[model samples]
Target: MKRTIKATFMAAMVGMSALGAEAADYKQNPFTLVYDGAIAKNEPGKVNIHPVTYRLNGLNIAANVYTPANYDPAKKYPAVVVAHPNGGVKEQVAGLYAQRLAEQGYITVAADAAYQGASEGQPRNVDKPANRIEDIHGMADFISQYAGVDQQRLGLLGICGGGGYSLAAAQTDKRFKALATLSMFNSGRVRRNGYVDSQLETILQRLQQASAARAQESAGGEVLYAGDANLTDEQIAKLPFALYRQGYEYYWKTYAHPNSTFKYTMSSLLDLMRFDATNQIELIDKPLLMIAGSKADSLYMSKEAFPKASGTQDKELFLLDGATHIETYWVPEYVDAAMGKLTTFYARTL
Candidate 1:
């Protein structure tokens, strides 16, 4: 009996180890930097983005750098690091924001988080928390060394899920003097608990179902992409949540970029529930700016993160009354406000 028990214990230990490896599979890739992806043929005043690679905990993550028109190599300039939304690429709104900011005289770098986009990784779109946080710091280290880059005056901006990582990055890294987000998604709050002040509770069972999804995968099955974007008119009408129609416009058709993957791992949502970037907001110690549509479903996320930030005297939260989540990302009126605040911010902080 004793011998049988020992063998069973060892088997269980091995199983646990394999499980841990799958959970953190993205931590081992090399960081890829594109020093000169496009220098010879960039339109004047247009945001010129180049592929950049950097190292963090030994991963070779990828990024795109957007320099302003007439960027003089001799003069120092402020820079912004943009983190894209979940399941988004460097070519998404993050890149758009970077280009716009660069046009306004700030240097910007929009990066693809590890295991997604063109970045290096296996089992893509895994959505690990540490990988996402590390990607932000890696961008910071890379841009701080550019010829005209001013290391002291740096800022970070995240959209959707990127907003949570930006908050996580600012919590520990002082490199960012100013931080902002558009429709900041509190991934953990939404995962472990339901959306908006715990409105959609009973998330624990959802996770258990995801675990079953992995078992299905282990048995030579296919991955299932959750979320129903193809809802009929009646389905759309039934959704009590606001901004989903707007979400479809941005993520599906309008402003939709080709690089984003329509499906990410259902299992990754497990890690998302455990994520809590806003937990240590009091430790951020920088200027915090939160922007979102007043009617957006994710508005409460921005509001929650802003107040918890410690020594956050320099913070400002902007709510566009009639706007929804996607509106702030690319709409003309909302973009103008963002442009003004962003330019003024780097100008003042840098």
Candidate 2:
């Protein structure tokens, strides 16, 4: 078993290294907010995009809502709320998925979690699990009453860290008729266990550090952060895990955005240390679909969490063959595979 695990991990690492060496550069038009795949403008009488804001838990949340071609206010349309990945904003993969879903005749909304992206908050980059779950709920709340959305047909799609929060949110919200996730990264598990459970021995020490960071915050001392460093190519290649190494390549090199960052307040770990995405997961009685890359190192997270959702009989675990953890974010073929499955699942359920 140990040998198999080691080999699987090494294979994933080597695959990501090849990906990192590719010369693909992501360039965007700042004026139009266009992203990968040449997403066209929201021309009149065609599919349109709307930027919106609303107050949630006393904080102003920023979000982008997309409506299908020739949208009519008099007609009701099914809606999906998309949750962005950790260290990701609404303008990246979440927006891509939202735009695709809108093209399929569903009204979709993707939002930046409070304190992250263009949203309003203090002491930015505080990545608390509870705040993330609330962001999902807040998206549902706003979109349910939007111009032509049918509240009864509400659905959700969360990617990476957002996926874990979506699971936690859907466990009780019930407002979401269907729930889906792509390349789900269990944030709490990774934070507590250190990626692939390699830091088990340091758990107590990390928790102590987190506690001290909290104390510093309470005393108005200098703020402390974690995982907020720049890495060179050599440094990145030397990282122990493929996820972290490729993650740096993705966020820093290819899809770099000023607001998107990997740093988070160390004090936030107080809540994260105890949070588990699979805790009370059985409470999700709605239809569920969890998608991951067949060759992704993070695939184990989805596999582990899928069976714990015992309350729902309507569930599926899909793997996009030949794709890795980060490739599904922008790779056309993999994105198409994921979108095809999502379209079918949401159409059937919602």
Model 2's alpha-carbon lDDT is 0.82
Q: What does each candidate score in C-alpha RMSD?
A: 11.4, 4.6
Model number with the top TM-score: 2
Give the per-residue lDDT digits (tens) of candidate 1, residues 220-339. Answer: 787644441244545433434444444443444444444455445667666766889788779888888888878777787887778788667888898877766766766667777777
Show where candidate 2 strays beyond 4 Å: 1-34, 38-40
Q: lDDT of all the models against the reference?
A: 0.67, 0.82
> Candidate 2, which ten residues in sequence have the lowest lDDT sum?
9-18
TM-score of each: 0.80, 0.92
| Candidate 2 C-alpha lDDT tens digits along 272-346 | 879999999999999999999998878899999999999999999999998888888878889999999999999
Instruction: Give the 10-residue window scoring lowest on summed lDDT in candidate 1.
Output: 13-22
Tell me how many clashing residue pairs each candidate has: 12, 0
Please provide the root mean square deviation of candidate 1 (C-alpha atoms, Å).
11.4
